[model samples]
Target: MKAIVATELGRGPRGLQYLDVAEPVAGKGEIVVAVRAAGVNFADSLMLAGRYQTRQPLPFSPGLEVAGTVESVGPGVTAFVPGDRVLAIPAFGGYAEKVAVSAERAVAIPADMDFVTAAGFPVAYGTSHLGLWHRARLRAGETLLVLGAAGGVGLTAVELGVLMGARVIAVAKGEAKLAVAKAQGAHHLIDAEVDDLKAAILATGGGVDVIYDPVGGALFEAGLKCANFEARALIIGFASGDVPQIAANRLLVKNVDVLGFWWGAYADKAPAVMADSFRTLIGWWQDGRLKPHVSDTRPLPLAAEALELVLERRSTGKVVITVGD
Candidate 1:
């Protein structure tokens, strides 16, 4: 097998090595997948820098989500068999030719969904669906504002927000990115590079009942000023590299709720909720309501370049690495 090995922490993507490695074998209750494609995420950079919440030991792969065919199954695994097409959240080690994952964490992808789209589906869509439906309880007919609307999770938020019947205000850096957001179902688009975010959001009328924020920092502060009374602001991540310091006084004045969400935590604390979330997302996909965007596809040898695309915010939706034919 060939894998991307991170030699040391803080070395960043440059430290990664694409070389021959021992193939992974299925352990008890686990399954070995012949990796077809893997999704690149911002967390991969954080993990390499040892800044992410879930830290792996040195010399590890950084990919989080992948899609592939099952190669083998370990004892106690009955749901999947060899040659099944599935998508999985491996937590790590997805930037390789093969990965060993728990059978419970793998889901059979729709027959019609291509491998690249399936590879990008789990994390970004799962975050938006779980955050909006389960955590925030977003009501239909409400106004929803999404920050970083052109990025991976942000784009998904815009799509799901509209599908759930909310008026979506997408905020991104430029027209091209906003155009992508519009195609994804954003009713209104704000150029964060020029327009005043707070004013742009307020201009949408009725203010904003819910805000899905993945790029924090200044945008988070601006969103607070535009939030409607009793609105919920879901904090997905700080992609802008500056974590916002929330002022409790603003929350008191508007009766707003600042909800922090981590979609990966649900896999451990509430597997049932995670399962249901996937079921709903898959249903939406089958109905043609959900379309995953894969903006760039790179081969395994260029895995570092794929991560660079995410780190530099050059790609929208998701950047996928094609691991094998």
Candidate 2:
């Protein structure tokens, strides 16, 4: 088996060194996945740089999701068999051609969900759904604002917000990204790089009912200004590298709630919850109501280049690495 080995915690190229390794055997209650595709996420870069909250042992793989068939099942596993198609948000070790994961952690892929697309769904879409549906409790006809709306998690929020019947106001860097968000079901767009985000949201609807902010820098502060009474601002990430400080006075004045979505932390404890969420997302995907956009798919050997593209923020939507040629 081959894996994009991260021998040390640092940035890409300096930390990542691909190498061959002995094939893994599934322990009890685990399954060995013949990974056909792997999802590239922002967290992957953070993990490589040792800057993420969750740190792995030295010399580990960085990918958090994978899609493929079960190559083999462990002794106690009964939910699936060899060759069963599944998508998983594994704790780690997804970058390899094969990975061993607990059977409880895997979800059977829908027949209509493509492997590459499924690889991207569990983390980004799942996180978006959990935040919007569970935490924010976003409702129909409400106004929702999504910052960094062109990235994976951000785009998923746009699509899900539309499915939930919210009038989505998307904020991104440029026209190209705004176009992408509009095509993915966002009702309005804000070019924050040029125009003001808070003013745009205020002009669009006076205020938004919910704000999905994946990049928490200046936008976090900007997001606070465009909240209606009881509005929920979901803090999804610090992708912008700055965790903006919030004044309690503003929260009190606006009577708004600041929510956080740390999807990975709930790992083993939230498998059943996430699985249920996946079922709902699957219906949308099948009915054409929920769509995950894949911007690029590079071969496994080109994984380095794919990371580079994501690091540069040049790629749009989800980037998948096809492990099998």
Candidate 3:
């Protein structure tokens, strides 16, 4: 099997090499998937550079989610059989021809969903779903603000926030990206490059009840300033490369709740929550309520380039790496 191997760290995505590697076999309680496509994420670049929270040993692949056909199931695995089409959260090693993952982490994808869409679904949708629905408890008629609203997880948050009946305000870098968010039902679009984020967000709905911020740093501070009393601010990630230090006075003044949500953590700490979240997400897809957007698809050989698209913020929605025909 051919895989993108990271032999060393701190060199970024350019350090990755597409080379022939040993095929993975199903281990106990795991299943081997012949990968059809893999989702590219910003964290892949972070992991490659040794800046992410989770670090695998050297000489590893960096993809976290994949969609493929089941090649084989390990002993004691009865939930999936060979030839099953499913998506798995492998945590690592998804940038390969085949990956072995625990059966518990794999979910059968809807028959109508393509491998490209399925490949990009789990992390972005799962993160927004769990963070907004479970953590923030976003309610209908309430004002919801999504920062970086045209990016992968940010787009999904815009869509879901609208569906959940909130009046969504989308913040993105340009008109092109803001237009994408508008099509997904954002009631208000703020150009982050031109407008004052705090004033624009406050002008639309007085103040936001919940803020979904995946691009931290200055944007987060601006969102915090425009938050409604007792607003729930969800800290999704730091895509801006700067982590903001929140002042204790701000939280106390507004009685706001700044919640940090790490979707991957649920896979290990609370597997049942992850499973239930996927079930709802798949149902929404089947009902024609969810539209997943894949901006670019590259061959497996260009896995590094796919990662680069995400790291450089050049691509909107999700970028996928196709493995085989």
Q: Candidate 3: minimum summed lDDT over ten consecutive residues — where?
A: 193-202
- Give each model's whole-structure lDDT: 0.92, 0.86, 0.93
| Candidate 2, lDDT over the whole model | 0.86
Lowest lDDT sum, 10 consecutive residues, model 2, at 8-17
lDDT (C-alpha) at residue 177 in model 3 = 88
Model 1 Cα shift for residue 218 (angstroms)? 0.3
Q: Which scores better on lDDT, 1 or 2?
A: 1
Candidate that would win on lDDT: 3
| Clashing residue pair totals per candidate (backbone < 3 A) | 0, 0, 0
Candidate 3 achieves a global lDDT of 0.93
Which stretches of candidate 2 lie above 4 Å from their native place? none
Better of 2 and 3 by lDDT: 3
| Candidate 1 residue pairs in clash (backbone atoms < 3 Å) | none
